[model samples]
Target: MMSNSKEIYESITTKTIVAEINLSCNDEQIDSISLTSEDLQNTIRIEAESSNSTNESYCSNIIEESEYKPDVPTEFVPVVNSVFKSLNLAVKMYNDYAEMSDYKVKKFFELHNHPLESIEERPYTKKARKMSYFEKEFVVHASKAKMGPTMAHKIRAVLKGGYEYVRVKVTDYKNLRRGVNIILCYKDAQIMINKMNDRRDHYPNYSFEFLRDGDMLAVMFWADEREKAFYAEFREVISFDVTFRTNKYKMVFVLFTTVDHHKKSVTVGAGLLSRETTESYEWLINAFLSAHKGKAPKVILTDQDPTIKQAVESVLPNSRHRLCMWHIMRKLQANVTDDLLKNKDFKKRFNKLVWNMHIKPDEFEKKWELIINEFNLEDKRWFNDMFELHDKWIHAYFSDTRMSALMKTTSRSESMNSFFNTYSQFGNLLLHFMMNYDTSIQKQRNTQKELDHLTKKAIYKFISPRPIEKTCCKSLYKYIVL
Candidate 1:
């Protein structure tokens, strides 16, 4: 039998919907939305045959397997155990579905809207009544008699120790509503509340905040949002090449910046903080991986500080860590004779030749060797000083793509150091801010950090003084964000 083209086309025109739904069986739920052409092929054939009363070939399944995904376009994931509240589930079923699969049974009462007919292998079991008090509330694990603790409970207890306290019940008796409130005296309540803050005596209550912390803490708070989704939107990379002053050589801070950002120290407490070790580099990495995951950077420009190198290796080993040529050039500039510094012509030519090292390593070396020969550099000890680890400092790997677009410089880190300079200049610790005595203060609190940066930049420029050039460094620039 044959059918007209228009009739055949009409049969295949309706939209095909693929959705993922939860399938609960005997206290278990599995989400899978993989409907292959074969699975729907029979249905398609039956509908077509009923409509056409004629055989026809349809080619809608011609798309590649690469395009197959049964989830809603923006649904992100097919299913989450978070969707159902009554299904406390082996609560442990979360740890490993396999364990839940092995241990699940049709215990006593069928808990949810869908019921399990038999005590078969599955994840969660129905809850039974014999309420008990949790630390924060009065509650009970469903089927406490047979089910025991859920997987979530087992994992939670193993990770976080259990503590108990009295709670005041806030109840609306008429509405069958009650809430448990922790009972704490002023002292205990204040102490816990203080700890909740970053232990800062003062903080500007914010309209918005970007909190960077460990995965464990992140997951606990934003469990529904992203467990390990701390990613950085970086435009540049700057390095703070300094060791901590902590008694134990702890990682106090990792000074960093982006071209489109500001220079700031990543200080997430030292020794046994939210993490285990105090190794400055290790903790530095903890901050980076915590902040920037998956979006591997192109390069990281740093100084030749061993501690910093260790931190970079642990956190972003793949990122190219190049020595800030500006810093290196300045270091040598100080050793350079006044005759060299004063002679603008010589300095200009010398500076031009040195910068070439970043772009064309071979050409820079060839030109440098020629310049040395042209100017008796061996006699002056200039050639001897530039050769050690020269490529490691100036090559493409360490070259910041973001910063290079600006004139190459470590001005960002220098700017941050300038900010730290005000405290550094005082050298003496202040017992308090004395906010009540603003008349005694020379500058506004808002201006203090900026003043420090300006002063430091002035001092660095006085010392390094090639010129004031913008850097492509991302984070450092963010500090002065408009």
Candidate 2:
């Protein structure tokens, strides 16, 4: 009975009307009545198969029964699918309506609101024209208010309820602050960023700071973690080298260190140099020390710059200053005559003499003495200086497998120097240096990521081909899927 009633009420196909009747007179209610001027005497009947209830109750019954679906399925799809599709449509329509409402509200405020100048309010678009005559006819007030049909204003006015309402709330921002973003647009930033990376100013957390101790200012930089946990896991390893700028007395200070693969891309400390001096280096070192107080490095790698060397040993007493082997080698090559340096046997023997990692210090010293005599470098200025640090160089520190490989040479440090030069040529100011900072680090990271990928690929290809292939696939999937 409920289903029947639902089906009946669901089928509403009439131009409905209701009339009051004399209920006790036994008069019948009409079901299908046709009114015509010619048939004025046509009698009406209730035509009910079962009708004991009141006339209104009977009509209500029919409406309630109309809720059910019909027995016959539509040609299109099942009722369940149709219901789902309808639900989806309803949600979409609701979202669209909400968006439209927001747009209208915003426009209404713009046209009718804001900017507190009291007078006769003039709408942005007063004289408006419509594309169709019906629209013009339907929208009589808008046409009167619009001065000219600026499409933008017209779109706003029409979508936004109207122009009068919109003119009410338009306003200028108060207490707004603005700052200069030199890499103004995305494309420009990209190019400059790329250029900085090429120069190895490093990327991600780039910083350019000028620390002044007296008159000299050092441009400091570090692309380390944002929280700057300058924990020198072992200790501080400072690698310093000087590269010239195109502008004279304008030195681009590129400072960095050697860390584990994971720690390679952090800027623990950095600064710029105007007049590279002891005081200037001292100030920069002090700033780094202040920030990373007890975490001073155990070793600092740098060339034989007297001022920088002195500053490091003085301030960071715990740090063991090691001269960059490359720099030492350069000095060795420079000091020795061309004939002596060109000795192929001497070059090979010297490298063997320096890299005595596995051997004891006494054994290394014994071999070093052999090379000294063979090359006649006993009295040579570079040979003695290079040999002067030999005791510290091949100590128990050099024999330690962990320290030896990482501290073997300043090649990685040189790579960092190359990085700084790649970035510094572009800008002289601090901000300019900072802007290129992250880009340099990102480049290093990207290179490392590539190397990692290649290494994984090679390893997988050789060890377990199928699993490696799957691993490679997973990486690729993640990249492209995102």
Q: Indicate which candidate wins on TM-score.
A: 2
The sequence of per-residue lDDT tens digits that candidate 2 reaches over residues 1-482 is: 54433322332323111111111222233222221211111111121212224344764454444433323323322221122122333223333433443311111112222222112332332221212344333232222222222433455556768866444222110001011222332243244335545444654444333444464433443335432443444344555555655222355565655564443533455556666678777767776665554466667767767888888877878777776665566666778789977988887877766654566777777888887787677887766765777754543454443354466456666677667556544323343445444456567667656766665555332345567777776686454322
Against the hidden reference, what TM-scores do the models get? Answer: 0.36, 0.47
lDDT, candidates in the order shown: 0.38, 0.48
Candidate 1 weakest ten by summed lDDT: 218-227
- For model 2, the stretches where C-alpha displacement exceeds 4 angstroms are 1-210, 213-236, 246-251, 262-266, 337-339, 374-377, 392-397, 446-482
> How many pairs in model 1 have backbone atoms within 3 A of each other, for residues 3 or more apart or on separate chains, i.e. clashes?
38
The backbone clash count of each candidate, in order, is 38, 54
Candidate with maximal lDDT: 2
- For candidate 1, what is the lDDT? 0.38
Local accuracy of candidate 1 as per-residue lDDT tens digits, 1-482: 34443443443342332112123334545332122233233443444444444433343332211333433333332242233322334232222332322322211112212332222212122221122344222122211111112432443344455411111211211111112112222233233334434423343321111223532221011000111211244434444444232112132323444443233332111111222232634644454444333455556667766766676667777776667777777676666677767878777777787666355666767777786676566666544755655655655333436544442455665654444433222211111111111211223224445755674465322334344433423334454443
